[model samples]
Target: MRSEPVPAPAGDRRSRATAELTWPGKRVGHHAGLVPVPSPARASWDVRGRLVCGERADSLLLRADAGVALAELLAAPGAVDGGVKLCYLDPPYNTGERFAHYDDRSDRAAWLSTLRDHLLLARELLAADGSLWLHLDDSEQHRARCVLDEVFGEEAFVATIIWQKRTSRDNRKAFSSMHDYIHVYAPAGPKVWKSVRNGLPDEGAFSNPDGDPRGPWRSVPMNVQAGHATAGQFYTVTTPTGVRHDPPPGRCWTYTAPRLAELVADGRVYWPRGGDGKPRLKRYQSEVTGLAPFTIWTADEVGDTGSAKRALLSEFPGLQAFDTPKPLGLLERIVSVATDPGDLVLDYYLGSGTTAVAAQRLGRRWIGVEQSARTVEEFTLPRLHAAWADAPGGGFAFGAF
Candidate 1:
């Protein structure tokens, strides 16, 4: 979006970014034959990508061009391995609105054009065991999904994580918009993706019964309906007190007679009025069907706009970078599910660098390369420095940076 070549300053600040810092790949810059611009580095100092080998802590604020960023990364991937594991990209929605740094606002056609640039690099830069989680709204979620299908292959598609970007309906239009989508696609083999099986609800319809020793227990009836004439399920059940019960006409027993007989002998079946009654299966909190992460993230679960604003204030008292930057808690949850400590995380649209700070706080290494130095300077840096002050052990020192 920077149409003219940025003239290098006369003094030491105009140093060239290294090959590791700048993609050696040839991209037609807005200016013909213009060299890629090198953004300043505070932590790992490089003219562009060449590492001076100062020191790396939990986080890095790498500045690079997304247009040519991948080319530079692929030109020297081995150097990039230590810092980037999971890449989160939110390209321009092409909604005809001007962004902070990239000013070439687009309509529908240009959005797709911008998307290809992001997808191509993500495929090239992402770890073979890593995953790419793309964020988009109704304007481009479907289009991006198709593009992902083409690049990562249809089978590589993970879950279409639905994030409730807003709580109340806009009511400004016919259909109120409240949610956004995050399409998750990962490497097919040796997945580096890390997710904790969320803890079970403490206060659900469960109670401690029989003191099974493995936690709380709950009841879920095992009666599966297979319609009429199901084999081996027409038999009658009787209680220990001689009360007989049959399947309610059309309904059939959950298990075949042989399996039911096995449970009958093992005393696993819970029959209230004796064996003659319909049976109920016991499901324990310990034995949940599958420990699943919450895909349906609501405003309450991830923090609403008000909370996000407060989080921004925690870092910058009276400054809000973009209209709706996500809460650090939301990102922490995403990081909790997508990556682990010592992993590399990248955010392409580093609005306020929430992902970078969250990773640092949670113990994961991060590299945030925002195109807008203004946003980084005004929004990201101050808060990140404050967070650095709160880091455990010694703290981040930009003097060495």
Candidate 2:
């Protein structure tokens, strides 16, 4: 493999001039830094420190520098253009805190430059409608957003989602921080990205009180603001029970007169007062895809950091839990939203292999790259083996470079 800074490809629109976040060693438009050579041999692991040879594995874990592994993947002959659907990164926060697994300290400019290198490679790995989810806290999210905007255009930004990572408050600090930020960016426009994104399954919003043959359904108001209404939308509606209702002030019927009549004939209209009140439109459960995701994610919906630690403890007893391991539910939500079955997921900062496990459980192909050999052997491999054994179908190959 080559050991040189790889410049952005010719004719890439990402090189266009825009406001950039300045750093001492910033390479500007170039993807700076050399990737380490990945080891040639690939081995399989059924559990921690146990090797299983000659099995077909669909996923991979490369114990090498993130940037290096990414470069190798790009250079592979089997690499597909626009192949990876999602890149979920949970890199070192550079918070200046020493942990058992990593040294979380680095110069600001150096860290940003390193992150820029990874982002550039990740960008190259993305599909046409792909997305990048960057997870960070207050440590460097502001500066990270600048780098993201510079690399993936400000117009590509989707949303800044807030995830409640903890429910308990720390009395030692002035104000306990309980949330983490997940910034989403898509090179494709937001609309195109969202069109491909999956929504959370609807929960407890549908019911059938009338025992309709169609099935459980939910009702919505049949009126909308009259500002853009046509003449037909302002017509009075007479219900089947002989009660006449006029379009409310500044509001008109959502449907035209003919459409409303057709709906009423088909028994798709719900009356609030036992079949003699304001009519509502019936939305059948079979017609619903799912509930649209919102900006805020509560710990109740997705497990908190504490729960993640407990899960790790239970999964691999006697092993030291990662200080900042992401909850499985959090990654599941992200994977579900960003990819479909068989789509490829890339996580350069694989850490404890949470991204790989999430992708595998959700039926997506994945590649995880981590630098720490100890962490890979102790935490990543064991956890992945457990996940693989529980969800037995696909296999993964592991290698140290």
Candidate 3:
């Protein structure tokens, strides 16, 4: 098996905007050169009480090159076509560094080409509402975005979420780079994905102080910027106590005068400061949806590198930890947002198997592909075993090419 990245020969690097990203050895299709598809070795290992087989399973840990494995899956009859709900990729950032499990460095062209191939296959594998979340650093974030925009279409491009990977400062460098970019893309376009996308659990404290018939509720701002407001939305709002109020400067009421009257008549409006304050919309618990996920994720909310490393050490003492491992919290958040229970999640670059563990625990089926067999056996498998012990029911099948 090849351990190091295949190097690309030097060639002209000029690129045309209309032609997409041009690089040396850039191929038109998903397969990188002539890749020999390896047959899956039907091997079984004792994973505690969990079933370990080569047949269909709730989850799969395939030990093979991701690009080759993706091609094979795509070609399989009635498999992986519009089925994957979410694909979370934590591929190499190509920082030109060699690590314990795998080499991080690769030629820019080769790296981008490999990524594009995987993405192209992933696109085919994704469901109609499926989405891809790619974790990357500044090293290739811009270029990767360009590639995603091309492959997934510009309209399918979602938000670029900023994750604070660390909080400590690196005084030695010119700047202390602490955050990582998670680029999201939906194959069927953002609008389609948004309709099915899951929202974060609302952490707001709701209460019904007025003892309304709707039970517990929370108030939301009823004023919006007057950017494109009609004159009908600029009327005064009278409270139950006959206090008249106008829209604040540069802001207009969220609803028209008639609509506001209807809401008020329905007791959906709340007045603060003992019915003296400005009106707000009262949203009942049953009517309230989950909070929309934020573009910025703090390290505290999602574990950072230090916390992830510490957790690894706690799980497996005296083990050589991976150079970079994503936190379980980060994967959990992604899974929760992109998939529901029973939805399939794919992670081709399953480095340390955090994605698998997270998906399993969250009641989502997953398929992980890792090129390194030793890493799978030594690191990924054990972590999964521990995770399975806690949430037992479905067992994962393990095989290698």
Q: State every prediction's TM-score relative to the real structure.
A: 0.70, 0.87, 0.90
All candidates in order of lDDT, best leading: 2, 3, 1
Number of backbone-clashing residue pairs for each candidate, in the order shown? 17, 0, 0
Estimate, for each residue in 1-401, the C-alpha lDDT of model 1 and write its tens digit.
11233232222211221221112242432223333333233225432333222244434565455655544445542536643557787666655566544553665555665565566665666655566788888777877777666566655566777877767767778998777788887654212232221222334477775665656777667666766546787777666677766777567778877887787676566665434556777666666643356668788778766678776766666654454567887788777666656677877677677887777777666666666676667886666676655654222322111
Lowest summed-lDDT stretch of 10 residues in model 2?
Answer: 45-54
Writing each residue's lDDT as its tens digit, candidate 2 over 1-401 gives 11233233223427432677798978845554544344353233221112321255667787888876776777664644447889999999999998889999999999998898888888877876778999999999999999888888887888999999999999998989999999998877576676678878877578899898999999989999999998889887877687999978999999998998889889999988866788899999887766678999999998999999898878778877788889999999999988888888988888888999999888787888889998888888877877777776667777666
lDDT of 3 by residue, 1-401 (tens): 11233232121111212336768988864344535343443223321113473233778887878987777676565545338989999998998889988999999998988888778778778876678999999989999998887677676777999999999999998999999999998766666566677788777778989899999998998999999999988988887777999999999999998898889889999898888888999988877667778999999998999999899878878889877888999999999999888889999999889999999898888888999987888789888887877876567877666
Off by over 4 Å in 3: 1-19, 29-56
lDDT of each: 0.60, 0.81, 0.80
If ranked by TM-score, best first, what sequence of candidates would result? 3, 2, 1
* lDDT against true structure, model 2: 0.81
Evaluated at residue 154, the lDDT of candidate 3 is 70
